[model samples]
Target: MSRPTFKRILLKLSGEVLMGQGQYGIDPETCDRVASEVKAIVDSGVELCMVVGGGNIFRGLAGAAQGFDRASADYMGMLATVMNALAMQNALEKAGVDTRVQSAIPMASVCEPYIRRRAQRHMEKGRVVLFAAGTGLPFFTTDTTAALRAAEMGCDALFKGTSVDGVYDADPKKVPTARRYDELSYDRVLADNLKVMDASAVALCRDSDIPIVVFSIRDEGNLAAVVGGEGTATIVRKPQA
Candidate 1:
């Protein structure tokens, strides 16, 4: 058996992943499946942190476009993330994994609020901490939050689990022939305008010198594979000398 490549990881999940068969709601099946995968990973001795997107339930920017206040809309998006985080927390605990939901926005009535020192303690105690609310501010996507958390947590890798398995030269959905990159330079990802993540998020990871592992989480066990350095991902890091 091969050794796991990381001691710790920060997983960024899209809110749409929780929707399952529903158009805009939490799907118990999807949550349970994800929880199962996470439990499997935890059993392998990896510390984990998570950041979930709120696009499935709501996107503040979408509301802003509909003539609503942009900041208010973003706050709403943040709240949606809290809901997803709580749902995920429930699933993980049911799977027998210790999990914590730390919200950027204070909601003491439910989960704990984001506190750097306390979050570190949670990880050291072998609990998976989920970060929600997008930096607790407007105009920043959860991608940046993932990148920021990975750097702060000093994780070995930042895994962006998306619908696609890897970053493509073009949108594979639109261009079937779009070329995929097994390895990519941080500079190139930004210059080409690849949809892997937002410029701010990619830039943060780049500056922090953390590699972003892009992979598909739909298939069971892929997360474990990527974390184990099985080479089933697009690894984005600094260019070689």
Candidate 2:
């Protein structure tokens, strides 16, 4: 199969990825490693942006289940994402990559508020933009935010960097025989209830005609390899007629 080339892409990272081998919170070394990988991508000339999840610090749904109001819990989750974004920004800057953090919730004291045109300009200037706060709304996951931002930025693809290499028919960790898909149609993924991403996020990408690439970020150099279409990953998009 021929590789799909992308001029621009949005990377969606779960907060747990920054935890390294620890049980919780961000790990500085993990952030630096991810930053190095991102620097390589940016230096390779791919316009990149990112949305980091906050599940590691405080999952809104989990908090809601523990007695917090759903809205309040979700807001806390959003703040956690902002913290993750700042950590990533620091790592990227330390690695010599110009970076910007924008929050939908508009914490001007810390980072810039998200502005579409301004973000576009940042990418045009070869800077990486980290979008935080998940749409400034309750009841939405960072997966949905990643899809929305990818569409808004006219990204060529949405790259979901997770612990697993690709989408599996079952949880790969629990099911040793789980089948991994190299490519799947958006309809197939949706109908099968595949865990490539949140249903809303997958649907948005489908509507926008943007492909979602699911791959492992834990492995060094996987991001670049996947971006070049030479790594173990799954591509979800509309099927060719």
Candidate 3:
């Protein structure tokens, strides 16, 4: 299959990815490696935006299960994302990549608040924009934020970089025979209960007519290869008529 050229893309990274070999928290070396991968894409002329999750630090659902109020737990998760964003910003800057961190929750002292036009300007000026804090509200995942931001920023696609290389019919780790899909449709994903992303995020991307590229960030240099359509991944979008 041919890969569609994406001039602009929003890369969604899970917080777990930053954990590296540890059980929790961000690893500086991991952040640096990811930053270098991002820099490669930016240097290759792709306008980049990013959204990183906070599961490694604080998970809203887990906190709620342990007795914390759902909203408050989610707020904590949002703060965790801010920390991750700052770490990423530092790494990107050290790599000589112009980067900005925009928070949905508006902590003016730490980073700039989310402004569509301002973000667009940053990308136009060849700077990478890191969107943090998950829509500044409770009950939303960074997945949804990535989708929403991708649409709002007029990004051509949403690149979901996870541990697995692509979407599969079942848990590949548990089910050794699980089938990996080269492509998928939004409706099929929802109908089949595929865990490529959360339902709301999938629906939003579907509604916005934006494709979601699921690929592995664990493989060094894979992001650049996937963006160039030479690496393994699953492209989820509307089925061709």
TM-score of each: 0.96, 0.99, 0.99
Kindly list the per-residue Cα lDDT of model 3 for residues 121-211, writing each as its tens digit: 9999999999999999999888989999999999999999999999999999999999999989999999999998899999999999999
Spell out the clash pairs found in candidate 2. none
Considering summed lDDT, which 10 consecutive residues are worst modelled in model 2?
A: 1-10
lDDT of each: 0.89, 0.96, 0.94
Measured by lDDT, the strongest candidate is 2
Model 1 Cα lDDT, one tens digit per residue, 169-205: 8888999999888888899999888878889999999
Sequence-dependent TM-score of model 2: 0.99
Count of backbone clashes for each model?
A: 0, 0, 0
Higher-lDDT candidate among 1 and 3? 3
Question: Best to worst by lDDT, what's the order?
Answer: 2, 3, 1
lDDT of 2 at 228: 87
Q: Model 3, residue 155: what's the lDDT?
A: 94
Model 3: number of backbone collisions: 0
lDDT for 57 in candidate 1 is 88
lDDT of 2: 0.96
Q: Which ranges in model 2 have alpha carbons more than 4 Å from their true place?
A: none
